[model samples]
Target chain A: MSSFLPDILALFFLFSLIIRRLGVNLAFQPATYQLLTYVLLLTIGLKGGQALTSEFTFSLISNSLIVIALGVVLTLVAMLIIHTFSAMNQSDRVTLAAHYGSVSVGTFAVALSYLQLKGVSYEAALNLYVALLELPSILVGLWWLNRNQSSTSLKTIFGHQSLMLLLIGLVIGGLYGDIAEPMVKQLQPLFAVMLALYLIHMGAVAGSKFGEFGSNQLFLICFAIFMPLLAAAIGLGTALLLGLSIGGTTLLMTLAASASYIAVPAVFEQAQPNANVAQALVASLAVTFSFNVIWGIPLYHHIAGVVA
Target chain B: MTLVFSFLTLLMLLAVTLVAQSTGMVVTNYFMLIAALVVYVGWKSRKSVKVSLLKRGRSAA
Candidate 1:
């Protein structure tokens, strides 16, 4: 996975840029994205479910509780970091905070795939954490959005496809993961291919928006890059506190460094009505997401090597 | 309107069943089948959309 990832990703990213240069129409991209997302998320969830069923323990359950609390705390820290960077409006800060605090499953998937490439075994419960971290930041953001608007609806937060699909994956893994063992063995090679397809689309989407990321002034751009590294530090520290393995520590760091594109926008739109979507998207996708994919993974892996 | 979400629900259930019930090699075999189905449908859908758009442009021109 390690050897092949860089070459294929670079090739795909460069290919996307070439297509953009040639002025080709990519009008079907959003639909393609929906299709890829459906396939990828379901695959991840199903595999995760199977993994979880292999060794379900009380100890793992307790560890998960700690991970959940970590999500809330990280979200607060993300808000604090954003506040420190720029004194944007309260709504904007809270919006950005929630996104930065929440996890990006794609980034997490990249990290896991990277580990798998390296033949490093991470905590399978790591799968559960992506879904677990999805909600708390928004919940925190909602509370931070307004103390008076304190009526938390767990239903609304849980309604997301990302979260629900994962839980379903876990349940499936617990109940019938072993049932599909025969089938899963033959499709193992395609895992990398599926992931590669997803990454190619990632490259195309990010490359198409290449100009938007650069339009920001030097300081804001720097701020966007800096926040994820800081989150990585916090993630690493938290993982150590929990006594997780090197692979698990690296993943936790990636989750910290990653920002949510999927769950956050819908959230802030309703919760903090005055928030700027463009600004948040730029910060999360153009800056943080790019940084993590390009350099953040290696840097986190380095940190794990030293600390873990 | 038969949306993608409806299909997604069924896929997730099937994926869970395959993953949960199977082990190593057999799981991969099943996944290959799933992958073929998704790719074929996605490609076909993409092709049809492009064809329709092209036809619309030609007629308008």
Candidate 2:
């Protein structure tokens, strides 16, 4: 039971939610969340880059291309569903689909922690898959939303703070891996604690959305819940075709299952000013993120184990 | 109306299928717990739902 410490700490989000409901005004500043996000993402990038320094193969390139394709397909399908079923305008639909289609770092961290807790071994290069999977969805969504104008430039998209941080870490770690090893090792022990704090912050944010849910949003709610499951199936099939290990399959599934609450929201707001970002947040952070943290990770692991 | 119902039904079916396919007791239990949470949310959202239904029924009457 002691070994389950990290897994247990994952529920701090629920604790944060309960305390907020009781009128505990802990007014955490925005910078706190921002700093936490930056540290964790950079850590992941460094680790993946370090591994690639030694283990880099042509296969990494191929795997990344496939993952990018997955992100694009997921975004397109989500846009189609929203367009078909909902009354959201073009910008809102594109914004919402981009949120669903991109990957969630928080969810990825939880899944990675789960794999480690279970003593499962996965490819170290899989960390690169996180950054790799983040871009294509947002790019595709931007293009789809602004197909008329030439405003969707590579500069604006790649300039996103989160993406830049990850890429910078990847480059530094890949080029100077020997020098970065000491820093990575120092940061390793603090990972779980940082994640717990981050989840608590996330929980409070998600909790605030609970009261905002209305019956009119039922289709969106259903889509939020169902998208992860559907994407997990796709992730699983891809993992198997690539001959990934069980741990790798589970992480891949989590990547596909997650929706972007951190990176894409700000970018989407900037890219499509007319879109209602709050609506997307309610679905992604409130419904899908909660589902993934509590249930989706374990279910994906179970399915992967059964298949492998 | 039928479209929303169709989607809800499809979601239920998919959730059931995934849970049914799980071989672990713990995983199955998680599914059960999520189902209960879904029901609670549904109950909470019933006010608007009931109001909409009541309006429809009165118009028909």
Tens digits of per-residue lDDT for model 2 on A125-172?
678888888888889888887788877656667777777888888888
How many clashing residue pairs appear in each of the predictions shown?
Answer: 36, 0
All models, RMSD in angstroms? 16.3, 2.9
Q: In candidate 1 chain A, where is summed lDDT lowest over 10 consecutive residues?
A: A213-222
Predicted structure 2: lDDT:
0.79
Task: Please list the residue runs of candidate 2 whose C-alpha ends up more than 4 Å from where it truly belongs after superposition.
Answer: A1-6, A25-27, A214-216, B1-22, B37-61
Distance (Å) between predicted and true CA of A267, model 2? 1.3
For candidate 1, give the lDDT.
0.68
Worst 10 residues of 2 chain A by lDDT: A1-10
Native contacts kept, each candidate: 0.00, 0.06
